[model samples]
Target: MLYLAGLAENSIVDGPGLRFTLFAQGCPHRCPGCQNPETWPFAGGQAAAPEQLVERIAQDPLVRGVTFSGGEPFAQAGEFARLGRLLRARGYEVACYTGYTFEQLFQNGNADQQALLHNLDVLVDGPFVQREQSLELAFRGSRNQRILDVPASLAAGRAVWVRARRWVLDEQPPEA
Candidate 1:
């Protein structure tokens, strides 16, 4: 079981294709200007089983993959790791968003965190920096975040960037 901030099915922006995004309900990194401030409190959000999430992920055949976003998915890496394994077993790709750098996670994070990292295909790491915010950036909110290829990084013993930016030409910002 895990505490969840929210869930979004058929999300195009969260990952490569239509994705089932899971927002785990606890964050230690309360980066300012965070879009999901409501998820900061670890105690908040509803308790859910990984199986329930699996059911949701399996609902759509066309869905490309599953994205684990958070108040900080690494906070409950064990649970997400389990879910990640299940999703991969079903032939679905997994992406995880986190505030910790890859080096930090490998050197300082617990075994569960390493386990979760091992199960992921892609990882978006680094905290959101309000001053570095840019609308043109890909899936990240700030310039500091990176889209890393997890398997490559682990094998090569260094971070491997997948795409420096996600192309979004002709996209207009919402009128404020």
Candidate 2:
């Protein structure tokens, strides 16, 4: 079961195309100036089954992508991973927004977090830094965040900026 703060049945802001965005409940990194402060608590969200969400997502044929937003999706990694697996099997592009960097998740995350990482096609990673916030960024709130190609990062064992034109328009990843 997935505990969600809310869901956007059709959203373009979350990704490149129309997407079904799931906002998980409960956030460990309560970044200041968060857009969704209501989602910071874990206890009040509506419980949803991943299968049911899949069914709901299927109702909209135009939504070919799914984005896991949060409340920190990794907090419920095991469940979200299952949902991501299901979504991928159905031919949906799966993306995620995470406060944790790929390096942190790669080197220190738990089994479920690693599993969830594997299931994503794209990952927008890093805590939202108020000082780094920018209006020009694409699909991200801060300059420190990255739009990563999940498979390549997993293979390289480091964060690899996605070369997709839609996600990155000459937005370079931070220097190592």
lDDT of 1: 0.85
Quote model 2's TM-score.
0.96
Please, what are the lDDT tens digits per residue for candidate 2 over residues 1-176? 99999999989888898999999999999999999999998888999999999999999999999999999999999999999999999999999999999999999999999999999999999999999999988799999898989999999888888877887754665543
Best candidate per TM-score, number?
2
List the candidate 2 regions with Cα displacement exceeding 4 Å: 170-176
Instruction: Estimate, for each residue in 1-176, the C-alpha lDDT of model 1 and write its tens digit.
Output: 88998889878777677888999998999999999999999886888888888887787898868999988999999999999988998898899999999989978889999999999989988999999999877678887777787898899887877642342222432221
Instruction: Give the candidate number with the greatest lDDT.
Output: 2
Cα deviation of 115 in candidate 1 (Å)? 0.4
Instruction: Specify the poorest-scoring 10-residue window by lDDT in model 2.
Output: 167-176
Off by over 4 Å in 1: 163-176
Q: Each model's TM-score?
A: 0.91, 0.96
* Alpha carbon lDDT at 92, candidate 2: 99
